[model samples]
Target: MPSALGEYFQDDDGSLPEIELRFAQPALLVAALEYLFGLPGAYDASRDTACVWNLIHDREEPYRSPQDARRVASGELAAFHRLLRAAQVDGCVLPDLGVFVSGEELILDYRMGPQWGESEIVALLRLLARLRKRGAQVAVPWWGESGERAFADAIAGIDAGRSAAN
Candidate 1:
């Protein structure tokens, strides 16, 4: 179960919060890239790193460009396990490889951040919005029930006037 977004940058103990997003299917990772790329921010997919597994040969090949990753993710390799490092054109507070793909789950762990600011939060929410729009189950295990409710409320209130409301 996930909780609400923490109000403070760090816990009372001075540790940063654990933030991660899980996608139930591997294809969702590709969907996430499309969603992120369409955002106002410019993401440098060229710097992205991808490790794609070949289902037929039972071997994995690593790629340093988004084109190759996208090709494999789009069913070129027929693989279920893929890892992608979605590089941001700006900012260093997030993980290097922002997304991970497993057999049936895609994980984005944000714990590598030195800190979580407004930009990071907005990036996360935007990604979540797309996942919801695509009818996939997005789980933020660190955010408890209240966090989930807050997210639902945010999505429900995504009219032109309150698109980013929490």
Candidate 2:
């Protein structure tokens, strides 16, 4: 069988899994949420259906709005950095910090968790694909000066890993 065929068969669900995307910038976070919510009709079904949640005191509370995330992103990030810096923290993952976006069928969860399953990884790939297809510039941290090449390399790595498993 072809490698593509073998890889396809390995996936139980050929659908995009629920995803949580972490953004380095508040503007980027807001933009991603806007796209998922179909700000300019990027997703017809999800338009106007996105909600934001802020993680505080180990609990989630509704943010004023998705755009409101930008307002608090700086403060939250600074505090988070301080927390990580204090006490030689290792493996001390923070719960769903900052803003989380959810829509009709899409979830840009943005939670900091300890484990990542294959489903979550695939979901992230699918999410990036969807975003790129919609004309959004999905810039990841490792993109370096050559984003296209880096992204292509990353996808190839996933495919190679899958092929090895088979």
Candidate 3:
């Protein structure tokens, strides 16, 4: 089975925008790209639901700090390089290509599902936390009706948990 993103990307109509593939692990990069390009059973969406962890960094002032931006950019690049290397060892293929940045934000896009298991989800949450620490806003783009419901449920669960905790 092919992943949802992989199948979508392969469509001739080109519905999706040109996304820059970035990662903290090089191994994931290779696997993700390979799966996107159709490497014969490279990805399985039913078994692998993709997660997008977006990091949004906000600036209070109109003046941007060049030094801070440069540092962020450097960190992003380093993370991506490491991700690429990790993907190679894990038998994961890189997406056709990807973009790199540091200060802007670190977005982690991954496909997960039943097969990914709880451990994977925990890992993803950790990654989200890391991005959040860097001042990025994390979000998951819901697809169809089911996806929307799932996201809603997730939010509800979090809200309920927070209320109970308080």
Best-performing candidate as measured by TM-score: 1
lDDT of 3 by residue, 1-166 (tens): 2232223223344232222224554334333333332433233332233222223443222212222234344442122211211222124333322222334433334333333333333323333343334334444452455544443354343334421111
Colliding residue pairs in candidate 2: 20-109
* Ranking of models by TM-score: 1, 2, 3
**Alpha-carbon deviation at 97 in model 2, angstroms:** 7.7
Count clashing residue pairs per candidate: 6, 1, 37
Residues 1-166 of candidate 2: C-alpha lDDT, one tens digit per residue: 2232222223444232223344545566667655443322122222234333334444433334345545456443111100011111122222221223322112332322323333434434444555544434444332234544544554555545432122
Error of 2 at 103 (Å): 22
N/CA/C clash count, model 1: 6
Worst 10 residues of 2 by lDDT: 80-89
Cα lDDT for residue 20, candidate 3:
29
Ranking by lDDT: 1, 2, 3
lDDT of 2 at 130: 53
Model 1 misses residue 142 by how many Å?
Answer: 3.2
Give me the runs in candidate 1 sitting further than 4 Å from their true place.
1-4, 7-29, 37-50, 64-97, 102-105, 112-114, 159-166
Q: What's the TM for model 2?
A: 0.31
Candidate 2 C-alpha error for residue 95, in Å: 9.6
- The parts of candidate 2 lying over 4 Å away from their true place are 1-31, 35-63, 67-114, 142-150, 154-166
> Model 2: number of clashes?
1
